[model samples]
Target: MSVTTTLRPPATNATAFVPSLGIALASAAAFGSSGPFAKSLLEAGWSPGAAVTARIGIAALVLLPVALVMLRGRWHLLRRNAGLLIAYGVVAVAAVQLAFFSAVQTLSVGVALLLEYLGVVLVVLWLWLRHGQRPRRWTVAGIALAVAGLVLVLDVLGGMRVDGVGVLWALGAAVGLAAYFVLSARDDTGLPPLVMATGGLVVGALALGVAGLVGVVPMTVTAADVDLAGLTLPWWVPVATLSLVAAAFAYASGVSATRPLGSKVAGFVGLTEVLFSLLFAWLLLGELPLPVQLLGGVLVVAGVVAVRYDELTAPREPDPAPSLTPEAPAPPR
Candidate 1:
């Protein structure tokens, strides 16, 4: 629709902080809930590939009308941003899910998750190396604490068994996760967040479906009922939640959060998804987390707070003064 959008510049201020944090947490909660629902589907004889593909496909269809409305009949918007759409879909959406699912086949969920969260470190490294956006000392400290907390939360030390192949796949997913934050935080892209989310899901769904047909991953599904939230419900309940709450709302809000929170801070906020997942599993499935895990959650929150504090307190580079327009005879002398 050629709707001009203005971007928030520089860093987050005190006034804008709450709204950004709220949206980020909302995204994390929505995304975290997907774990239990997806788990239930798997227990009900749905392959990981099938569950992911269906979730993405249905979410895309659900968001299509809204995305089109945002597009406002500006066909050129798609043409101009095709590369971004494809990359977001392929790397951030498809690759992340595919690789993580594949990794879990060999590795324990906790270990695989720890490895994938290495994407946080990778994000820091990428910014440092690629854009020279070196992390402040506090940012680095927060990252270390967050990762250490993750190890505790995931009980990675308790499961020292490793598979070489799964490590590689998880690392690949880490890259994909990094791509997600990097792509989402970009302000120069003309595409709206909802449009980008929808397009990425569509592309990811097609890619995974093709992989399934070629036998790269299993595509089996069953009509059996599943146990979730201690209730035996038809398989569709989890499926619907995964598509609507997890994929649609989660991705849209997650994408929008990056515009204000920036990539690094948003990644820090994303670490909370693990905490939310545990909370959901406990509430919905009656599985309580250990005391140590509760401690880990606190550390994770501390890490996020540390990063937010740094962003607000850090000194800003002063903006350059504007040049006077052709004031001195357009002097090129």
Candidate 2:
């Protein structure tokens, strides 16, 4: 039930507003395509662990310099929030990626993604049950429609073969991703989004690196193992793109966007990522989503929209003021 929203700083300006919104949209697009990008690398022979390691590791390296520059004199913040930071890194960033990669190893990318969106439902459920907020009839109906769409998309009853283990991994990914949003919501303004992203990535990198060294997962650098067979480009192309553009830029921009959009609107607007991924796949990979999967994607969007609508239209309980001081106000969607 954990959901992290990006930490926001109080600010008001047309310039900041436009840029933050743009960045948020772009970040969502990058994140949405993460699955397809990772899938491509796997098809090109990269192990799921290796691909994820490369992604977070290189991204950490890229952001480290930026974080250090902006976060000067803030080592105390990092030290103080070390525990939460580690949770953000390991569970939210690393575990989600690893589980997603494993899921796609056995499930079609679309089906896996659809399953992962179940996290939105989990978020709604958490808000209802734990927060004691009653969900409206429309919200409940939206959830049912989304679930039905998933069944159609997955064709679960149509004898589509899927690995049980992979399904479990995807379900876990949903949980991790849901936790990520919740955790982000708690991020304080004193800790900038880039700084938080950097810390999390560093932790994720170190943990994955350790796992690799221990033979729990392979981290070999053999040229043969890094082969890129399906692609006409160099072996490092995907890795580089994934690390800098997809992971580093994507996460940084996403956190920045939260500053203006607030957590809830940002989450729902972020759903546009699925559409972006589908479009990207059509152009780059020549992959077309099935009819049901496309419909499912629409339903998923609808469900998130429902949540946003409920929050906006319904009377809301007063939120407890966040305990963490110096909270940044998230931006409007």
lDDT of each: 0.87, 0.71
Q: Give, for candidate 1, the lowest lDDT window spanning 10 residues.
A: 1-10
- Candidate 1 C-alpha error for residue 21, in Å: 1.2
Count of steric clashes across candidates, in order: 2, 19
> Model 1, 91: alpha-carbon shift in Å?
0.9
The digit string of per-residue lDDT tens for model 1 on 56-168 reads 99999999999998999787989987878888888899999999999999999999999998897887787778776678988888987898899889888887658999999
Residue 107 lDDT (model 2): 85
C-alpha RMSD values across all candidates: 4.1, 7.8
lDDT of 1: 0.87
Model 1: CA > 4 A from native: 1-10, 321-333
